[model samples]
Target: MDIVGDSGATGYGVVDPHNGWVAKMRLAMPNTRINNYAHDGAMVSDFLPGGRWPDTTDAVRRIGVDQPSLVFIELGGNEYYIDRDPAQYKANLETLTQNIWQVSPRSTIVYETIWPFDPRQSTSMHSWDEYGAAMQQLAVEYSAGWIDLRQFFPPHYADDTYTHLLNTDQIHPTDAGNVVEYTAVLNIINRC
Candidate 1:
């Protein structure tokens, strides 16, 4: 399975001054083959134009286009920071989804909704409820699977949702957070 995201997925299994929990899951799934390609501070728009991030085509090129059985995308959070235009975001997402399907027709694509964050701390508050609904709509439109990580994380993780899970900024997920995410991925795949 391919796990793509920002610092959350990238920081997994990495050791820094602040100990992360990705190592925890390694013990759970000793034989798990997780290919995490999330970069630090990445957004969906970055994959579009005018952003200094690698395009989806380029990123997927490195992942082998023979048709991955599963391709999970964790994005949208960073894009909310730049453009609040939902229309543009939706168009870009549609294009990206089409591209992925064209490259890997047999692949089951999973689109993750933006996780919840504390509105008090975050300068950009993209509505997870709305974004999630939109993502679900897109999933139905494209016949893909939609995973709602934002719904599972709330109450405890709300005050500073993303930060509470991150050792540094309010963007990355903590080890426990990663486990929650990983389980979600597993559940989705199992259902498929």
Candidate 2:
């Protein structure tokens, strides 16, 4: 399996991303290989021109020439930070889905929801709910997987108030938090 997205998927603020939850997954599977292309501060729209990372031509293109069997995506927080509308979020996700399917027809794509944040402190309020719906719709439309990680962290200003999942930044997950995410994702894979 391969992964891509923003800082959250990169295990930002934690140990080396490879040594993060991805490492846990690797340890558990042993035989399964996981490649992570999650860059820090990467937005869903960054794959295209006019956003940050103009160097990125396309989303799936960053995965190299090898076709991966599975891909887990976690983006949109940076998109929200950029104040992008949900329509654009949906469009970018659509393009990502199309590109991945084209590049790796046999690959199964799974979309992970962004971190749960206080909408009052965010740039746009509707982006969360709207983007979530968009992800679900796209998943169903493409026969892909969608894991709503929001359930793991319903935190607000205080990250560790409820669960010691979020870091002080209230964005990225802590080391233990990464384990939670990995466990959730692994559960889905085991069922399949």
Candidate achieving the largest lDDT: 2
Task: Please provide, for model 2 over 1-192, each residue's C-alpha lDDT reduced to its tens digit, 9 standing for 90 to 100.
Answer: 888777777777775555467777888889887887777888776665565664445446755465888888887887666667878888988987777777788888898886576544544556467777878888999888889987777765554365567776766788878887888889889877
The TM-score that candidate 1 achieves is 0.74
CA lDDT of each prediction against the hidden true structure: 0.61, 0.75
Local accuracy of candidate 1 as per-residue lDDT tens digits, 1-192: 565566555654334513332344345556865555667677665554455665433665544544567777777665555536566667767776776666666778888874565433356545545555666778899888888887656644546543454435444566666667767766776687
lDDT of 1: 0.61
The 10-residue segment with the lowest total lDDT in model 1:
17-26
Which portions of model 1 miss their true places by more than 4 Å? 12-33, 48-51, 54-57, 64-66, 119-126, 155-168
Inter-residue clash pairs, candidate 1: 21-175, 165-174
Q: lDDT score of model 2?
A: 0.75
